[model samples]
Target: MSTIDVVEVQPPALWEAKRTKQRTVVWQEFGLLGIFTDQKPKIKQDGICSQQLLSTTEKSGVMDSVGVPGPEEYEEQHVHEVYEQIASHFSSTRYKPWPIVESFLQSLVPGAIGLDVGCGNGKYLTVNREVFIVGSDRSTNLVKIASQHQPHAAIVADTLSLPHQAGRFDFAISIAVVHHLSTPERRKEAVQEILRCLNAEGKALLYVWALEQKTSRRGWDEGHEQDVMVPWVMKTGKKNPNEDGSMEKTFQRYYHLYRSGELEADIAAVGGKLIDSGYEKDNWWAIFQR
Candidate 1:
């Protein structure tokens, strides 16, 4: 079993870890995605914030055919660690909010308290200032950048084990997040967690990569392996070019592309009532209520 230890840090950085041996698996070099920045909350690098320590088994991020690590360990390497390493670069490219997600936020009522459960760089947190949002992500680095968004908060947290109370949030969004889990059971569990955070009438939006995007650049469509490793190439500065004159290092992250009806199926499996759902820009999105 994995345990999370919440430690309060007081320093030049709020909730920042200062070299702790809490990770069951040490940080490893890997390529992953990033998120955004805007707004300035009452931040204090010298103030107090909380850090969560996730203890899970170790696994290399490399793809292999045999002896595959469990979902927790696999995600730790292929997902969380990669995001931490590429937070800045990832955030730089992720500024634009998806139209579907943007519309969802704009539709919310004023003063609505919500959660962005896998809230990378917190680009959505900027969508509706009339309402309040608490964003959470597994990457501490991303959370720090996301924390800059004002009238909102960001914290280091995992989708499967959020720090918020159940049935408390008015709404929630977990965009482009559930696809990162390596197993069907884990993906369903992720949906359950999202629904768990909602009030009786609260709605949650979720997005996942679609398997039927033949028109997209990746040209992935039906019949392609749903479970696959996608590569992210991070370009280092010109000062670090390799002999091939390429200054890029590629890292692979695992994704389980959702076919049509899959997102709704997962929501239904977890006893959530589907409010709305559709595909947009190579992803399947759904809004559901608990």
Candidate 2:
């Protein structure tokens, strides 16, 4: 009979001091276990010990086994969550409808069925009251806010997959929407979806954030990531009882800034003919026919 010895090794004094209440214990009989004090675990996988060390870093917010999000997921998270969080504040600021968009809306025939994709607060839906507009948004809260604006119909739907029959709408408008889509494929799909819902001779307007914007203070010549996060500051008028609430909270939103001719290219990619396309007020606007 062979006797095995069990030794309880104490972690280094440096590691012991940094250990928090949250600790992950791995039991192994024989092997050199490398525990890092910098929150990054360097584990050796060979011989008798084949298990991997699973740890999380608080400072970096990176966790093991939890997969990182792709661009699409990050876009969805920011678009959905940020809008939901700031829906009230957003509705308050979006009271005025764009005159250019209103002029386009007026061009539609009276009693025409129109689709307002990604309609936040339904500001544009109120335009051309003669045309019965059906508003749809990805954010449920914003949809609810839009419902208050008295659209003919309000539905929660994704831009990529609109909840409408083919050729059901005489016209469609996707304002400030396509840029939220993370990938080119998704942006194309959204345009295709709008075209699918419109009649064969129908026309649609699409708007996206422009790379050149005076308000953004981003230089046109400066190199920047196409996909970026913009912050929205939330105002809380009253100070907290416990502490001074002078610090305003800000929410970050995902936006895919469009370069010159990008909007037209996206429309052309979806088999739509671009009637007109240009930049206006920090956004790229395009009118297309299906």
Best by TM-score: 1
Encode model 2's per-residue lDDT on 1-290: one tens digit a residue. Answer: 13222222211111222333223322222322323333433333322221222235462323222554554566667778889888889999997777679889999888899899999878897777788988998888899988876537778988877889999889999899889877778889999999999898789999888877634333322243455555566765566321443434555566778988888998899899998988788888999988
Which residue segments of model 2 deviate by more than 4 Å?
Answer: 1-66, 214-222, 239-244
Best by lDDT: 1
What is the C-alpha local distance difference test score of each model? Answer: 0.75, 0.69
Q: Give each prediction's root-mean-square deviation over alpha carbons.
A: 15.3, 16.0
Candidate 1 has which clashing residue pairs, if any? Answer: 12-45, 34-90, 35-91
* Residue 175 lDDT, candidate 1, scale 0-100: 90
- Candidate 1 lDDT, 213-242, residue by residue in tens: 867655567865576555567887799886
